[model samples]
Target: MNIKQYLDSTYLKTAFQTGISETENEIVVKNAIKEAIDEGFKLIMIRSEYVALAREMILQANSNLNVGTVIDFPEGKSSLETKVKEANEAIANGADDLDFVCNYEAFKNGDTELVKQEVLVATQIGLANNKTVKWIIEVAALSDKEIIQLSSLIKNIVISNFKEEDYASVFVKSSTGFYKTDDNSPNGVTIPAIIMMLENASPLPVKAAGGVKSYEEAIEMIRLGVKRIGTSSAKAIANGGNIPNQY
Candidate 1:
């Protein structure tokens, strides 16, 4: 398999999250962007602040590598307006695709309308801008039933609100790679969780993110019907190696 083509080469660490200075964080982002260009990965997924820079770099290199950004990223607790605004700004800055963290907590709390509203508005913004939009439903934080519900929720919203031809642009992604677990367990995408997502979010593509560690694992995800694989280890995976860190 051409695993690099399925990879969304990712670097989403903030300065505060890494305990590094802003300059150090920029280096990490720049390195990922360079690798994506040199290696011909599918997309370079970065924090929104660097979308413009990544765009400029990709243009300079004359590569068709896409620039994707996260919205309401690791945390999905932001207000709907905040998420939509973030998405708009990222698109204007040259983001080709957007991965949004769905407000899974709200849906689990019985606030289904709020969850639906957030996704509806965000998906609209992306579709309007002719960009791909993937909703990150942190599977580790949800029960099996919640995964089914949220995955179907996103699919249903798109089907109801968008034309049939636009279905391919929306995806139900598996994780944000940053949710906390009580036992400090690996909270990344799991086979069972992805199966649930695929079955429930039918017709809409699924992206397996988080702990996809190697080329073999990525192949497994694609075989199971995942259309995208999000990982910081994309270069390693493409090289048939593995990285130790989850992100």
Candidate 2:
């Protein structure tokens, strides 16, 4: 319930065997993931196709790391129908959590309704199968005005679609690290920006990704109101960044 419960202090530390683009030769990445699992990094996020394999990998490591994957990924430009299918397939393949991108075009067109509907569909589908649906807002891609709009719309959607008894959780995440240019925090996911979102996002946990590469950075995010951090470095933070030759 406290802030630290949501911090992803060690992200890259979990990048041992990434299925995102096929780490056919980088055995170190795979080894790191296994080591991270054994080291007790319980929440692990992998690509859609890698979820089942990662799940099996987790088992082989003899660890209980929860598995999660992204939908629509970095762009959030996928059609609603496509996103729905991605969510279905990911969940069916054994994903415990889903980070979906925002429909920027929908928001730009002032289609708040459409945006909410997209989230609602995902929320509904994920709920039916007992999965968690977290919407990735890509804070860096939007303006201040757009961010506020997203907050208001997200707030409305949470109440309208997810009933308390339904047992589903909706979240607004910042960054997906899929941007072609940079792989760092927010691009604009700064402390102030995230703080603003988290303060207003009542009942919704904010997952901050990108630009979070250190314990101080991760802790800063928590202090700024982020409830969870979508980091891949689980072991580094737990080790004070002293892992021998850790990438």
Candidate 3:
């Protein structure tokens, strides 16, 4: 297939499934995912803790679906070593893909070595266990220097990971739009950087996530070389905006 065809095939490949802890959502996001999957979404993302439960649910549905979970999640405050272990553990339990958040403070402080180390550890864990790892470069938190710096670091890290065959999908993400830095601009996996990263990384590929809420935006990300997406705006796209989320 041509690049355009490949792009269309993967775009919104399925509505991305999201999670909010039951405590965070008295309505429980798991139930929402179940309903979403039934509605014909084949790709879903949930908390690392719920990996096994999600696996069981998907298996019982007897449908072709891939389940994704996070590592280091919305926070990069956890120790790098801990993040790697969490990645390994999540995969062992049944995570089809890992969307990992990098240590933002380290990247922001110009600690390239630390950033590489964190990514290295997690990628090693993923490779060791045949798991997939994706680096979520929260694009919103960086200065232009930080972005360019971390991008090189990720390139190096991906090279290292590839040499060892520890490769997973790498993503330039926009949110956790996250905390820890005082910046709170609504960010996303920008089309330009996504293209640049793919042009540089070649076969390693990238996943564009966050703020992806429509068929138009999703297609743009795909056009920019993203092989995957993360969005809560699934129903909006699938039904021509018919089933609006009540959030």
Candidate 4:
């Protein structure tokens, strides 16, 4: 399979997280952008602060690579207004895809209306801007039943409110790649989790993120019917090598 097309080459670490200075961290981001361009990956997923940089680089190279940025990253507890504002800023800065962390906590707390409202509004902003929108459900933070329920929740929202042609523009993504579990478990996409998402989120595409580190694992996800795979090890995976311990 042509794996590069399915890969969203990602780097979302901050200076503090990487134990490096801000300047050094930016250098890392720049290198990642360059690598994505040279490798012809589908998209480059970075923090919103670097959206402008990725846009300028892609423009300079005259490449077709799209720029993707996260909104309300890692934590999905932000208010609806805050999420919309963040998504708008990312779009203005030239982001082609907006990956929003869904309010999974609220869903778990039995606040379905809040979750539905955010999905509807955030998706409207993205579709109106002619951008692809993804909802990161953070499967690591949920149980099996929650995963299926939340995936179906997103699917129902899109199907009920959006046009048929617009369905492809919205996706129910698996994780944020930054959630930590207390017992150090796999806090990312697992086969079971992905299966649940694919079955319930259908008609809307699914993206498998987090803990997908190797070419083999990526292929498996794609074969299991995920349309996209987000990983920090895109370069190694593209080269058919296995690199572990990355988001």
- Candidate closest to the true structure, highest TM-score: 4
Show the colliding residue pairs in model 1. Answer: none
| TM-score for candidate 2, residues paired by index | 0.82
Off by over 4 Å in 1: none
Ranking, lDDT, top scorer first: 4, 1, 2, 3
Name the runs in model 4 displaced over 4 angstroms: none
lDDT of 1 by residue, 1-247 (tens): 6878899999988899999999999998999899999999999999999999999999999999999999998878999999989999999999999999988889889999999888888899899999999999999999999999999999999999999988999999999998889997779899999999999999999999999987788889999999999999888898889777676
lDDT of 2 by residue, 1-247 (tens): 2333454332232243354443552354455456656665546666676678767788887776677788887678888899999998988888888778889767987788788888788888888888877887777777777876787678677787678664236777777755543554336366766876776666677777766666666677776766677655655654445222221
Q: Which residue runs of candidate 3 sit more than 4 Å off their true CA positions? A: 1-27, 39-42, 164-174, 177-184, 242-247
Q: Write the per-residue lDDT of candidate 4 for residues 1-247, one digit (tens) a residue.
A: 7899999999999999989999999999999999999999999999999999999999999999999999999899999999999999999999999999999999999999999999999999999999999999999999999999999999999999999999999999999989999999999999999999999999999999999988899999999999999999999998989988898
lDDT of 4 at 38: 98
> By the TM-score metric, which is better: model 1 or model 3?
1
Query: What shift in Å separates residue 60 of candidate 2 from its native position after superposition?
Result: 3.2
- TM, every model: 0.98, 0.82, 0.78, 0.99
Candidate 3 structure, TM-score to reference: 0.78
The window of 10 residues in a row where model 3 has the poorest summed lDDT is 5-14
What C-alpha lDDT do the candidate models reach, one value each?
Answer: 0.92, 0.68, 0.61, 0.96
lDDT of 3 by residue, 1-247 (tens): 2222111111211123334444555235556457556666646666676678778888898855667777776767688877878887888888776778888777777677788888777776666666566777776676555666666677687776566344435544444433433554446556665665666555666766655556676667666767766665555555445222211
Q: Please state every model's RMSD to the true fold in angstroms.
A: 0.9, 4.4, 5.4, 0.6
